[model samples]
Every structure is written in C-alpha cells, then in structure tokens.
Target: MRTTLSRRSLIAAGASLLAAPALAQSGYPNRQIRIIVAFAPGGATDILGRIVADHLSKAWNTQVIVDNKTGAGGNLGSDLVAKAPPDGYTLLLGTVGSAVTNQFLYKNMPFDSATAFTNVALVGEVANVLAVHPSVPAKTVQEYVALAKSKPGQINYGSPAIGGTGHLAMEYLQSLTGMKVEHIVYRGSSLVLQDLLAGNIPSTMDNLPAYIPHINTGKLRALGVSSAKRWFAMPDVPTIAEQGVPGYDAAPWWYVSGPAGLPPDITKKLSDEIVKGVSSPEVDKRIKDAGCAP
Candidate 1:
C-alpha cells in the first residue's frame, strides 16, 4: 500500500528533529543530580556545596545530593567529575586548589584542572583569617610576622591540609615576608579548629567560617583577613594587603563544575540555576552568616 504524507506532516517531522537538543536540555531535571565535594564533611567546601544543592533541589523540583570523595588533596573527587559523562548529572564542588593550583603542585594528576572541567558557577568566597590564639601576644600581621621570624620552626601554624588555600596563603605570606614557621596540616577546618581552640596550635590562616566566632569572642586574635579587601562579616577587620603585605590576596573559594564537553544548552541552564542559588537574597544572607561572601 502506498500512502502519501501530508506537507504539514513533513514540516512537523522537520521541526521535531530541529527541537531535539533544546528539548532535551529544557527537560533536564527529570532525574537527580549529584554534586561531589572534594573534601570531607563539615568544611567550608562541604557547607557551600550543601547550600547550593539544597537550593537547586528546590529550584528544579528534583533531588540534588552531595557526595564526599575525600583524598589526594581534593584530586580524587575532582577526577571523578572530570571523567564523568557530560550529561550534566554529575558535578564537582571544587575549590581554588582543585580547580586551579593543584596541577602545579602535584606531579601525577588524573585530569588537568584547566581542561577537564567546565566552570559552572562560583559557590562561595571565604576570607581566610590570619589568627593567633589569645595567648600568642600578637596584635597585627606585622607583629605576627616578626614573631614567626623570631621563633622560626618552633611557632606552629595550622591549615586545613597541605596545598589547601590556607596552607598556600600562609606559605605565600612567608615567602613575601621571609618568615619561617612550622606548618600544621589537618584533615579539614573542624579538626584544625579543635586543635586551635585547645591551644595545641598557636596560629592559623583558616577559613573565616570556622574561626569567626572565636575571633569575635576574643579567643583568637585576628591579625588580618586574607581577602584583598576587608570581609563584609567583619568590616572593622583589616586585610593582609592593608596590614603589611601589600597586594596580598589568597582568599579561599569554591566553585561548581561539570565534566568538560557538556552541551552548551545544559551548561547554561545549570549555570543559571547555580548562580541563582548562591546569589539570591535569602541564600546570600545564609552564605554571609556562614562567614563567606556569596
């Protein structure tokens, strides 16, 4: 049997073919999406990831989960997202180290930070506070630098981990000021704060979220904030740049990313959702409450 197709039917077929990609991306959240955190739970990275995931779940009416894949100084989780399918389901909540600096420090990387992931959206910006325990007797960054020089390796300063922004920030300060101090590495901010509160570590350049309360309480003397400008949460506090290290800026940050090669439509959709999640008035207040700049 021979059947003639209507001209309208042929036009409809062509339209369907043209709409395939756009349709696929527009209906995106038909399934769950997962954001992989490169560090363990309770750190600034984890906190910001969870905040973004929560807002995304609401925005998309689909579940969004945070999976912690800690190890290799945040490389393991980052590599997983880098190699995942570009369907936009799997994303990495990576930090400055994972997305930018780790390649220079590590010899064998599973994926190139610059090429393996598409920069989705920035999640949060945290000023690392250069703080010393109340007993340290340091009132300013210059004094702290002088103290470190006098004590050298005997003065212990802690960071979340090796190669983390906190560690690198302190190292950069050392390089600029010619100050030498022992570096203490912890698994995450919580553990580092534990030791810091106990007076086991004398000083740290840790994220502001974990140390802000102590700084306000006078338990730790905040010598300077690592941001180029003073952080909003503590407007009275000075930045390291203003304090003495001119032009110094090593603030910790987190960003959303997905495997490279994602379809442009889906990438844009995801980026819009992420930007909304972190920048909305409600979320912005929450991020600042957590002692970060969204």
Candidate 2:
C-alpha cells in the first residue's frame, strides 16, 4: 500500500529514533498504551495490532494493550480514536478501509479518514487470496472463472465487508473475468473464514493471515492471490495478474496513527519504533509466517 512514508523516509525515521533523546523528560508512556483494532480478533489488522503492541511494550517498557472495538463498518473504533486525547497513549492500527477508503462508502461518516488522524507509519500489507472450499473442483483461477461463468450469479462468495478491499477485489475480479458471482458481506474475517471452513460458502476472498493456515491444511484451495506478485508465504500460488488479469493488484495495507492533534514528536516516536520493529529479521519472518508483509 502506498503512503506518505517512502522507503527512504522509513529508513531515516528508524535511525533517527534510536539516537533521539528518551521520550520526553517526564518519561513518555509511563503507563500502559492502548492500540485500538477496529475489527474482531483473528483478522489481519488484529494480528498486526498484537504484533505491534508486543514490540511497543518491550521497547517502551510499558504494557501495550490491543483493544478490539468492532462496529459500524469500522467507524466506531476509529471514531473513538478520533475523539480520544492526543497524548499518544491511545493509538489506532487502522486498515485500508478505516484509514483510507471508508469515507467514500459510508453515508454518515463520523470523521474524515484522511484528516482525522496523524498518519504515522506503514505497518505493512498482506495479500488477499481468492480461496474456495475444498469441495470446489476448480483448482486454478481460470477454472474457477469458467465454473462461475457456467453457473453465473448462482455462485456466491463471502467478503469481509461491503466496501472493504476484499469485497472490492472480488468485484474487480468479476469485471476482469466477466463472471457474475453473488457477494455476501460479513462483519469480520473470522466469521467469513469460519463459514468457508465449514463449507457453508463455496468461495471467498480474505486477507492472507486468516486463510493461509486453512489453505496449508488443505481445508481451502487458493485460486489466486490479489497482489501483483505471489506472496512470499505462498510462493507457489500464482497471482491473479499472472493467471490472466493483467495488472490486477489490490492488497490491503495497514497504518498506525493517533488522534488528529497528536504531537509531532510523539507521532515520530511511534513511527520510528514501528519501522524498526517491522524491519527486524525475526519480526519479518514472523510476519511472513502470519501471511503478511513487514
């Protein structure tokens, strides 16, 4: 996912943080820090939130908590942060929808996703894979498209939310492949994945974190990843662009942020810590194993 933090800026931020003076003479983060995750547990954003919280906890020598605040197409939790004090103790690990595309979808948006918070760091992104239950006979994306064409609108797929990247990715697939499939929206990835695993839904598209283990266990078959290139964790699976749809890429990115009035130094401190943590080799491997990019 693209962001204001370019590669060079990220590298410089990390180096600057390490040598910078200890956060505030009063000792910032004297108490626990809370990272608000706008979805239920087990989604990509939740998993990444936990990872970041763990790192920040260790780095600042304070307890960092992941508070799951799910509701209103992700507006509830996000609004909580938007209204929270800008002392930097309360952070938000908002996804692409909450931080970027949500403003265009919801009629009564609580806050301007673009301006309500201070964009701190790029927390990394994960590919969304088009997956089907094992019962589906189609193995590749082309085969799946052919099958869908045969059945047309009868075939249904699950998405995390109505205007989420997963839903839009599948919609984009429909336009590219010329297949008309039904879409069912869910509040979160866990439930959608649960139904898919139970064979209640024939197919679905979700972030790589929630679906990779099932795919690895052969419970779900990955038709194609939505990234431009095959993800590192699933190197054997071809991307949709490679399969047939050229230039098809819609991976959802995550970013860390605080309320709109957060101090610049506080934002930089958080961003620096996150960049350093994400750049570490051990954390990189862990992120890959979680089916994400760091």
Candidate 3:
C-alpha cells in the first residue's frame, strides 16, 4: 500500500528547495561590480564592455564600471579576474581568444581554463571582414584569390597578432584555397589598421566595425565577411563560404563570467541581468550596426 505525503511534510520539502536558491541569491553584489576588459580602450571588447556596464548600472541600480587591462593577448586581464575574490562584485568580459582558444596558442598560461571561472552568459559575437587596401588590384573575392594565386608569396596579409582569430581564419582560408601568402603580425589592431590605410600592407582581416567605415569611404575594399551568412548591417557583402571557400565561419564572441564556486543564487542573478541587458532593443540595434549579427 502507498500513502501520500502529509501536507506539512510536502510543504517543508518545497520550502527547503526554494530556500536554497534564495540563500544563494542573498548577500551577493553588495557593492560595485567591476568588469575587466582584456583589451585596450577603442577596441571592440572595450566598447561592448562599456555598453553592458551602462545597461547593468541602470537595471541593478548599482555602479558597474569597465576596467581596461590589456596585455599578453588578453591573458593579463583574464588572469586578474580569474584570481579575484569569488564574490559577485568582480566579473570578466571574456573573449574567444582569452577563454576558449588561448590555451591552444599559449604555452605558459597562468590560469587553468577548466577551473578558473564559471561561464555566466554569452554577450554576443562579432564578425570579421577581409579587407584590402586600395592599392590592391582585387575588386572582388574571385579577383583577390586569382591575384594571390598568381603572386604566390608576393601577396601579404596583416593580422592583429600571430595565432589570433584573424590569423587562424586566414590560415584556414589558405588551407582551402591552396594559395600561399605571407603573413604580417601587428602588435594590435590600431597598428594593423594604420598600416593598411597607409598602403603599407595590402590586405588584412579585422572586425567589421573597425573596417566598415573605411570600406564605405573606399579607403579599404571589403572582399567578404567571415560569418556563416551575410551581415544585417552590410547586406550586400557576401560571406566567405558563398564567395569561394566553403565552411569558413570564424568570429569572436564576448561572454561574462566570475571566479569559480560562486554561490548559485548570485550566479542566477548575474545571468538574469545580463540576459536582460543584451535583450534590450537599444543594445540589439547597437550590436547590429556594428556589422555583427547578435
């Protein structure tokens, strides 16, 4: 014979389950929250961080500040947040370079990607554009590939850094096209863009926001975008896959995370707020205008 639980017992069990999340949520983020951007100001990461901080500040009625700590291909800033107190006050605006692919590229990383932090929320992804200086004779993707094939090692391309997403994406393109081209690594995007505009480097893959304005003014010509589909902002631009190379999708993503072992309540609260911020129409429009499909 089976018997149902008494009302008192059932009520107690339900209350216990509810209490756990409530306890986890309490006493979290009692002070200002600091978001660490692993790159310098004027970059995509810094811009996204500021937007998130502003939205969160208004929503939570608490101070949220973005701190730019740039170095070591984003390892310096990421490591700082990884080692910070597990309290909810400290957070990281982690990117694909710092969070997902850094381990594969760097040999002596300070923090272990597996245990350093918990993934809170994915902020968004940014598409990259393959752009060339006006001096290049290529007018379209087909023309560029043909020119590279004919020139072989004579054609050069610049990237923000060696083994960065831009570099790897171009390498993937090379593997597909079976074309040989020289690679030029710059310390940062600013240097890469400056050289590209000055006609020092003929071609480079960079974030769309950084190249879109120049592409519009005819300073640089966009060959294609590095995404699965055409961007909403640049509807006319074809994706690399559509142009020639098949299955060539590469983009950098931004995510929010805190140190490992954060209380479950605090985690939920933070994630909830981030989802809210990213879902806002204003934020969505800003992201779209940046030539990235959020």
Candidate 4:
C-alpha cells in the first residue's frame, strides 16, 4: 500500500511529542526520560536512539535511557509510549512501521498510529541493501532475480519485520520483477545478519549500516541497494533502479516522538534539542559512519 503521509507531512509530523496535561515548562523533566526503541539493540533504530538519548541527557542534565521493546513489528513498544502519560518523559525512537506503514499492514492496531504519538524530530533516512551470503549463486540484481524466478518460492530471504521497509522493499522488488521468494522475518537486522553469516539464511534486505562491515569483508555480497542513488558508504554498489529495476526506491527513516497531546513548549524544546543533536558535526559524522545521511 502507498503512504498518504507526504514529505511535507513527515517534516511537520516530526515536530511534535507526547501530549495530555501540560507540565510546567520549568519543572517538566525533573525525572529520567525513557526513549523506547521498538526494535532489537543492534539495529539502526537502537544506534540512533542511544545517540539522541545521550544528547538529551547532557542537554537536560538528567538521565535518559533507551528501552528496547521488541515484538509484533514494533507495535508493542510504540503502544507503550502511546499509552504513556503525555509528560514528555516517555518518548519513542520510531521507525516507518510504528509511525505509518504498520497502520496499513496490520488488521487490528493496538494504538492509533495516526493519533497516538507526536513527532519530535526526523533523525535521518537509511538505505536498505539487498545482500546475499557469499555462498548464494547470484552476484547481482539481475542474476538474483533470474535465480529466484528459476527456483520460484524455494529461495528464502530475511528481513527485520513484516511491515518494515526492508520487507516492503523486497515485496516491491517481487512485484516489479515477478519473482517469488519466501520471507524469513526476524526481530531485527542484527539477528538476520547473525543468521546470514552463519549460513542459516541465504540472503537479506536490511538497513545498510549493520551489513556494511560484512559486505566489505566478503562475508556477504551486496546485490543492490534500495535507494534512488548509490549510497555514499558503498559507492561501488549500484542502486536497484540502476540495475534493471527502475523506480525502485524504498529508504526508511527514523524519528523521535512522544505520546500525543504534548504541550507546545515541551514539543518545541524537544524538537529543537533533537534537531541540534542530529545536526552537530560530531554526531553528523557518527551518523555517516553508520551508513546514514545526517
């Protein structure tokens, strides 16, 4: 399903946080702030969540922690923040699934993704790479597609979650190329990478960061990237669109958000701090090093 959330809405949606009874601006964050990461600890979400949490902690002179609440394609953790009191203390390092896409993929969402939380700040977008174990026969996108078509549903590929961009990008690839493959869904990219390295899984479409080191070490072969253009970190790897599949761009982004109904002052403060932290030269380089553009 296509997303109704446009680029403009995404930018605006990123400027809010939790809401309800507004806390006094001066005394708002007297306690520790919890930023829930709705995925496993080694994925892009967890990495960026910790960066933002550290920044917030120093900025506010208080403790900020990233709580990993994994399961049900991130709905479990996102729901925790949605139901949290709109005091701004509880926030979410949200992904596309928790923010928008899951609303279409799941039949009965626990919380209204549209109304549950406020968008505090957009972190950055990361490319999803289609990489295979070195043992796989295919070495390029065309080869992979041809191989999948030959084997039909026999080929198994792993992704972080069902509704996640990694999975959707693969689905989009199948729709465009008419190739049938089985999806082996995992809790996060870290786990998928572990299995892929162990030769337990043949291939994966996941965020570029965690796969970069292995791709460089020849543990995995990057067939194509799911971005419009070449990713800076892996410039040698061509985009999916460049390799016979035109218009195949499916980059996922990260953001900070809190329960809906956050006070305007608190929202602005959090948004400003998040934007500042993400834009800092030091943090900027870190994001780039992690294979994402800050």
Which of the numbered candidates is closest to the native, going by highest TM-score? Answer: 4
Q: In model 3, which regions exceed 4 Å deviation?
A: 1-20, 23-27
Model 4 lDDT tens row, 212-260: 9999999999999998989999999999999999998898888888898
- Candidate order by lDDT, decreasing, is 4, 2, 1, 3
Which of the predicted structures, 1 or 3, would earn the higher lDDT when compared with the native?
Answer: 1
Pairs with backbone N, CA or C atoms under 3 Å apart (clashes), candidate 1: none
TM-score of 3: 0.87
Cα RMSDs, all models: 10.7, 2.6, 8.6, 2.8
Preferred candidate (TM-score higher): 1 or 3: 1
Residue ranges of candidate 4 with Cα displaced over 4 Å:
1-24
lDDT of 2 at 223: 92
Candidate 1 accuracy as lDDT: 0.81
Best by lDDT: 4
The clash count for each model shown is 0, 0, 2, 7
Give the least accurate 10-residue stretch of model 3, judged by summed lDDT: 1-10
Name the lDDT value of residue 132 in candidate 3: 94
lDDT of each: 0.81, 0.84, 0.77, 0.87
Q: Model 3: per-residue lDDT, tens digit, 14-85?
A: 323433534545766567999998776766777788888988888878899999887777888889988998
| Order of quality (TM-score) | 4, 2, 1, 3
Which 10 successive residues of model 4 have the least lDDT summed? 1-10
Winner of 2 and 3 under TM-score: 2
| Model 2: lDDT of residue 146 | 94
